[model samples]
Target: MSDNRRIAEEIIKAVGGKENISSIAHCATRLRIMVEDKENINQPAIEEIDKVKGAFYNSGQYQVILGTGTVNRIYEEVEKLGIEGMSKSDQSKEAAKNGNLLQRSIRSLGDVFVPIIPVLVATGLFMGLRGLVMQEQILALFGLTLADISDNFILFTQILTDTAFIFLPALVAWSAFRVFGGTPIIGLVLGLMLVSPSLPNAWGAAVGDVEPINFFGFIPVVGYQGSVLPAFIAGIIGAKLERQIRKRVPEALDLIVTPFLTLLVMSFLSLFIIGPLFKSVEEYILQGTLFVLGLPLGLGGLLIGFFHQIIVITGVHQIFNLLEIQLLDKFGNNPFNAIITAAIAAQGGAALAVGVKTKSKKLKALALPSSLSAFLGITEPAIFGVNLRYGKPFLMGLIGGAVGGFTASLLGLKATGMAITVIPGTLLYLNGQILPYLLVNMIAIGVAFTLTWLFGYSDKEKKM
Candidate 1:
């Protein structure tokens, strides 16, 4: 209809149009297309388009990397082409759909989760700073002791950190409603139902005794405070119901009557059907995950750790937060802590290797300091400067991380608590068996450093 819309139509046609596209998703900078056949898509034609940055086929998807602020508009255009059925074209989609109700219920949980990360990071850092201040000897110099500052800071950060989660249903409800193009108020009401104080607790005794509450002597709704998927489900239902009611209502009374009926009906449906069902599924997923993690810890650790960095790159690492939170709730700790630890170490290790191997003084200088930053768990410098530049270092780092993860898993090392600072965070895992994990950390670094050095260096450098 317009230039942007025309461009989207043209791009869709270039990618073999509606028939060829099996599914499509867009990240901040890339359009990921799953096509029925790669041969059907016209690559050069799409790339030749003014806004299209680049195109590549990898990991069984056709990726069109775009400039900033272009992805959403492109995605909307693709949706207008009636491509919603594309995701179901994949064979795995059915299995993914059937595996668990909660799995199907929270369709785009990652999408809902990712936008909140900056908030999480900010609050975590604030909390960490508060802890650091309390440990400072200068507290007394300011006429304050550890006790004076600790309570206030702790409460402040806890409120900030927990607000999103405590009212998780409301957040998910709002996000889901927005996604479905419904009223935020409708979504908010649905979310409140899930996390309402009157709702029954379904996480059982291990979760500190929750009593099942009955509404009207029939409908059973569970407490969903700090829970993710159930509220999302409720929100979707509420939005859909709202859409339907809006269409049926008379123009004169549509505003008030539509919302009133939508909220009332949706709330009842969520309580009777969606809330309890998703809560059960969430609990099952938690148990299944823990069971998997308990198996040959080394192999589990290796797979999980090796993919941690790669997962972060794709912006889906937040999906793992559900796992981490479940673990913390159940066992007071998590095994995948080492996965993140090793991923950060691998970046550092690779950067160090690059610093030593590269001939360019500028490159070396950048690599060395970037490597140090990686040790602090800041990965952008290492990812862009070292990994993307050298390439080999990234692969080496993956291998080393897998090795380290395996070792930590074998020793049954687990994080006692979460830490934002990588170096000091390692101490979170401290116990009688800390040495084994430390050794594993060292070995991973060693392997990455040695491999990168041997493979990354040029012949001239060796001869010199």
Candidate 2:
């Protein structure tokens, strides 16, 4: 039998047979199954299957991390076994019903922000590329000075790097509205109002280049260009209000009246109350994060790096999106990126050690690919399929993260962007940061690999 077919059959048996599954679906990298009873499934057996990266119960679904192409193929094989497959939307609804308040909240935040990360990643790459060409050293190599650069070309580069952040509220608001079941277009309009040209820009107002417009003599308002919390709050409020208004208005008037009242009332409340209040709250959050990251001797990085993947396992790592947004919004440099990349790289290193030391060809196959995925900044496979399963490698990976994080902090490493980390993350460290970025990753991977090879893996424990 083909590997995927055999793996699929093994999975059904491991999860307590096909009778225990309520529904199944596949995302980009996982097979999400809603089981009839969690207690019935053997998670260890599932994780031990060849090509199965990891298995865990999350939200309301038992997710098997099977990598990208493998998941689609395995899922197809699963379908051939007579188990029904659900749509992604249906799967989301099923999973949504399972998490507690905190899980749901974090998941909602993740849902809202995750869609927007690609834009930011692309923008960061653009920023790095722009910075690269603008450097005096790079320009000197071309025998051209900064003044020789065309103003039009410079303006175009600014458009690429600045557009996403300049309209970030719109993206956040739109995403939030979609997640909260509101009209996304209305949310987009609302977000645009927050950054309207009539108001003084937030950056300009902060630097005192322009004064904020005051309402009722005390309430001050400015354009929210690089804001997060306010936009998200506005989206939720707007969506809720729209839903409430829709229920009250007559069908004939609903089309016109619902949007009108939603916009009118929400605009005032958002600008006067929500925007101002949450902006301060966001600032406080930003300050608190800075305090943690700024701890003496990189202790902050050490702590976060060590615990980062642990947080990922608990499924609350989405909350870090807020901190990262705050960092990018305030300082334009994200130290968190550097620290987390080290943490992620260490997992890959540890997994690689397992691949090297194991005599079992089945394990070698799983370990090598899983390690590659971790290096690309996706760590579920490495963490679940290899390191965590082996016990000692997971701890070794954490220690590697701590040491690498300290080096990053001591050397003052930061990235031009967020989201992308490890290898593709190199884009964020361009311009002048290439060497230190490489050094930090190498050290992290090196430490984890050495430690795991020496102490984490054992051929005696290999079952295959």
Candidate 3:
């Protein structure tokens, strides 16, 4: 039999055979199986299977870590064994049913933010590259200066770096509307209205360059460029309103009245109530984040880095999506990215140590690749497959993360983007920030690796 087929069969047996499985699905790195009864599965036997990095119970599924490309192959083989599977959409619904209110909310937030991340990442890269070429030192090296660049060229660069954030509300609202079961096109139009060209820009109004429009000589109004809460709130309210309207309107009128009423009512609500109220809320949140990150002696960064990975294990770290966007919108730099990169790097380092120190060839194979994945900015494999499996290694990783975070804050390190970290994260720091960025990651990896090698790992664990 082929290796994938054998592995698939072994996984089936370990999970208590086809009879115990209700459904199966594969993500980028995991084979998620919904089992009829968790008690019937042999967890140890699954861990011992060759090429199986690790396995864990999460939300309501038994997720087996089988690496990137391997997961699809193994999943296909598993299906060929007579057990049917579900689509990723079905899998999400099943998983959603299992989490608590908070977990589900966070997961929903993640789902909304995920689709917009690539655009933001691209904008960040554009900003980084622009900053790099425009630097005094770099330009001087090329016998050029900032004034030497054409005005049109600079305008083009600004367009690339600024367009995503300028329309971020539209993207967020569209995604939120879709997630909340509303008409996404209506959401898009509502978001656009928030930042309509006729209104005074939020930033300009803030700096007194443009005066806000007074609706009734008191209620101030301005474009919501770079605002998040207002768009998100508007999206949710609009979606719920549309759903309610759909239920009431006759079938013939539903098509016309539903969207018209939803947009008309939501537009007024967004500009008059949700926009102003949530703008303050967003500011307060930003202030709170700044206060924490501004704590003395890098303590804030230390705490965040130390706890970030732990939070990931619980599956609620998507809350950072809001904070990072707020930071980038306000300060144009994200210190949070620098700190979390350290936490992620430490996980890889610990896994790498495990891979090197273990005498068991089985473990060595899993550990090395899992660590590589973590360094590339995905940590589930490293955290679940290697470091977390060995108690001491995870502790060592936390310490490494804490120290790295401290150093990052001390140096005031930041990134141009979110979503990517560690190896791919370098692109976000290329605007004269590469040296300190590399320092933070290297220290994190060094500390975690040294600690794990010297004290965290033991060949004796092979016997266990």
TM-score of each: 0.63, 0.94, 0.94
* Worst window of 10 by summed lDDT in candidate 1: 87-96
User: Total clashes, candidate 2?
Assistant: 0
Residues 1-464 of candidate 2 have per-residue lDDT tens digits of: 99989999999999999889989998778999999999999977897787888888888899999997889999999999999999765576568777788887787788789889999988888978887888999999989999999989999998998899999999999988887778999999999999999999999998999999999999999999999999999998899889999999999999899999989998998899999999999999899989989999889989988999999988889989889877877787889999999999999999999998898888899999999999998999999888888899999999999888888988898788889899999999887998999999999999999999998889886555
Error of 2 at 301 (Å): 1.6
For residue 3, what is the lDDT in candidate 1? 64
Tens digits of per-residue lDDT, candidate 3, 107-174, equal: 87877787888899898888788888888999999899888999999999989988989998999999
Please give, for residues 2-98, the per-residue lDDT of candidate 1 as tens digits. 6668777888899898889877876555677877888998976875564564566644567675533666787787788787634322322332333
**Better model by lDDT, 1 or 2?**
2
Model 2 clash pairs are none
Q: Candidate 2 versus the native: TM-score?
A: 0.94
Scored by lDDT, model 1 comes in at 0.67
